[model samples]
Target: MRVNFTIEGPPVGKARPRVTRKVTYTPKKTSQYEDLVRYTAINSFDGCFDHDEPVDVRIVAYFPIPKSWSKKRRQLCLINKELPIKRPDIDNVSKIIMDGMNPKMKRNKQLHRMVEVMRGIYHDDKQVTTLVVKKRYAERPRVEVRIKRDMGD
Candidate 1:
């Protein structure tokens, strides 16, 4: 089975977990982005992805050209002559999206509430046998995600 979806707006990288003497938690920005990814994935298709199958994931993150860049540079980026080589590294972007789609269960600690139960794309990120990630520039910034079962050779 294969699933495909796009998360609109600027792509966000996974932020490092904050640690205090008392407890550790995900940053608000990271948490919010993850929620968006999860919500989009859950609603993208009619059926849930299988749990035990090996999968391959590919992500392409598109960034908007900076206003400070000259017209020539902006044109280059738009045509793929130049790429996004700044912050929000590719690895971080991929990590957040994978975590967002994986099934999760946690107990104890903060008393807010547990994450809502939903059919997830896969059992865990570890089940991903292949991953491909890329970053580019676009007129409308967004992240495109593709997940598919891996049929081994």
Candidate 2:
């Protein structure tokens, strides 16, 4: 089984700058970043799964290329299916998504582990992140048993 969801917005990365007040220092998610993750996860995961199942998470991040880029570069990107090899690094992107999914996965016994992850970048008209969760293994028997009682072969 595979679960799928798409969040359309600028992907929020995990890098957080720390702020110090006199003596104490605190690290927090940026307001914009926090809102982005919360809004997407809550809305998308709501009423999605009743039980947790083990999953191998896969993420494809489609980043929008700005119009500021030279026409030659833009055309090349569009024609060749170019990757967005720019900011909001891969690990940071993963962190944001994983945090959002915590509440949903915590409750389910079936979702014991998220075994694997594959991440990538691609060019698209708009910024979007697609999440694909695949079951770790087939729980049911793959082959059907046939009875020989009728045909005695």
Candidate 3:
């Protein structure tokens, strides 16, 4: 199955450390990442997916280009070493998307190994999250193998 939709929110990462206190720390329950996941899970059609098997997830993150950047950079007219680097790396964003699908995913299965995820980013005028999920199958690459035999044999 395929799910194509956009999520509007600031992308979050899992790198943040838990609160250090004597009281209980609800690590898995509260965080910006978790909040976004909760929101997405409720809105996304991702619930329709049956996660009893492996799935391939492809998501693209589009971040708003900083207005502070020079006109040349914004227009892509200057091709220099200056990169359009942004917070929350592609991998982190992908993780957030997977976590958002946690409710639909079976916990008994090793989610990481079973999931084939792909991610990308683009600096644009809008902040958007595009997600796509589909079934994964074995499509082994074709390789030609040949054996040599003696003519006299």
Off by over 4 Å in 2: 17-35, 46-52, 104-153
Off by over 4 Å in 3: 19-32, 77-83, 104-153
Task: Please report, as a residue range, the 10-residue window in candidate 2 with the lowest summed lDDT.
Answer: 141-150
TM-score of each: 0.89, 0.49, 0.50
Would you list the clashing residue pairs of candidate 1? none
What lDDT, from 0 to 1, does candidate 2 have?
0.43
Ranking by TM-score: 1, 3, 2
Report the error of model 3 at residue 121, Å.
22
- Model 1: runs farther than 4 Å from truth? 108-116
Pairs of residues clashing in candidate 2: 52-111
Best by lDDT: 1
User: On residues 1-153, what C-alpha lDDT tens digit does candidate 2 reach at each position?
Assistant: 333455565565666656566543224554445345445544544333223222344655555666587777766665544556666777667655555444422223477664323111211112223334211111121111111111112
RMSD of each candidate?
2.8, 15.8, 16.1
